[model samples]
Target chain A: MAPLIGVVEFPGTNCERDVAHVLEILGGRAEILWHGESSVKGADAIVIPGGFAHGDYLRAGAIARFSPVMTAVAEFARGGGPVLGICNGFQVLTEAGLLPGALHKNSGLRFLCQEVALEVVGTDNIIGSRLEPGRVLHIPINHFEGSYVCSHDTLRNITESGQIVLRYVDNPNGSVGSIAAVANIEGNVVGMMPHPERASDVLLGSTDGIDVLGSLIDCLAGDTEPTPVDQGH
Target chain B: MRFDVKVEVRPRAGIADPEGATVGKALRALGFEGVGDSTTVHVGKLIEFDLEAPDVPTARDRVDAMCHTLLTNPVIEDYSFEVIPADSGSGD
Candidate 1:
């Protein structure tokens, strides 16, 4: 059966349709779930695409964290469901505490819009399984607060545990060690600053993001590869 | 009442925060290299205030409330304030 992927949409969120469209192109039936919804009833996986939820009034994702939909996403992730967060969605994940660290403003204090090169570092998660370490992929990023920061010890642990799935090649946000993406301890959830959904098709620019999303489809299809965690330094 | 308020802002981690790093480099260039060991130096604005209130505690409480609701982004920033008596216009 084709995977039923749900995309959550908040009031200020603008990327829901784009993500949903991408999922359809990738052979999955994508549905947009309103933020007030309580459950992922028919979702095999979920994607929280990028957007300025809540006008970024309270530290980007802070306000959106309290939305009713998050509770459902949290529960879904806890149940071993695959979840992916891109850009603002990444911010929301951190705000919801589904993932660690927070996405803060760009160090330059400017809203950045450009394609970034990311190096895959962890593959245990569904998003990482399709790409090899050192492989460079290009994805567009449009955000003011995209920095990923955490305590030194937590950063160390994330690195040691192979949870740092993506790293910006140019260190765009001054994130600790250019960490662009990370997965939860269970590897079922991932939050990344680059927008993979935006680049799934060649007409959009780069198809590198397809590999990342394709991994999700593979995961839903029960392509159970024992992608063991790598303690990459 | 006199209240002391400070606004602290730091760059989010792993961002190519050129502004913060530039400032750090500027500090080192100015011979304050000891500041290195640090990439970002948080910037803050201190707002001291004197408010006429029934009591010092009341003034402090009001000021603290103002800070959270208006003075800073509580999600990304933390703040603290102290209240003291404001001296009358000293023209001596």
Candidate 2:
């Protein structure tokens, strides 16, 4: 049986289908889990896909963080289950305290949508474990508040602890340290600005996303689980 | 008793404030006095809410929790608050 992946969709989340399609194609079964769901429906992994949750009214990911589904995501992460949050989903993760730091406005104060080259920096994560370190991958980023912000202490900790997973080659959005993705201390949960779903197929212009998503699929399928030392930290 | 609460949120010092910078630039372009390249500005949020609490201290504490939990992201922002009885003035 294909590992079931839960794709969480808040009211304004528009990428659930896209993410689900990609997951299904990647050898995982995807189930669209609504924000109101109190449980993750017994899925093996959870994904919070990109979109303007709650219209981004209070702030990106602010209101959505309060949704009941987040409770399950938090529990799953705590239990060492894999969880991935992309784009606005990343915003929601930080808002819910599942991930450190916050996503602020692009330093240029403009919405950005473009392809960016991401250099794999931390392989201690589910998504990064499948890729070679220092490898650059082409992925598309679409967001307004994708710049990562954290205190100096948080930066130092994540840097020393290998919590940073991906970085933009050109520092496109003024993210601190050019960080494009971050993982939790346990390395079970990761939040990334780039949309790996959008880069899943070569027909979509790039297959680099396969390496990212494929890494997670490998973990879900029981093909890979690296010890802390093997994570290459 | 009901209290009217106002919470102000701002990015912490040293954090980038591009929105505030853009506003500052606009002000300078409009020829506002005392505004210059060195004039540092940071835009923040003002959130007002009505709370039910027994007393002033209780109301303040509740608002503080709200700021910590939702109104602000402590990792990147700081917040302050003002509280008044809901009926103290005309908000109707």
Worst 10 residues of 2 chain B by lDDT: B33-42
DockQ of each: 0.20, 0.83
Worst 10-residue stretch by lDDT in candidate 2 chain A?
A224-233
Per-model clash counts, in order, read: 13, 0
Model 1 agreement with the true structure over A1-233: per-residue lDDT tens digits: 57788998988999999888767777777899888998986798989888888897747777887789889999988888999998988988888888888776677777889999998899999787678998999998888888777777788988899899999999876677899999998899999988887777778898887788878877876733333221111
Error of 2 at A178 (Å): 0.4
Q: Which numbered prediction scores highest in lDDT against the true structure?
A: 2
The runs of at least 3 residues in candidate 1 whose Cα sits more than 4 Å from the true structure, single-residue gaps closed, are A223-233, B1-76, B81-92
Highest TM-score model number:
2
Per-residue lDDT for A48-114 in model 2, tens only? 9999999998789989989999998889889999999999999999999999999999999889999
Q: Alpha carbon lDDT of residue B77, candidate 2?
A: 89
Reference-based lDDT, each prediction: 0.78, 0.88
Candidate 2 backbone collisions, by pair: none
Cα deviation in Å at residue A102, candidate 1? 0.8
Q: Report residue A163 deviation for candidate 1 (angstroms).
A: 0.3
How would the docking of model 2 be graded? high
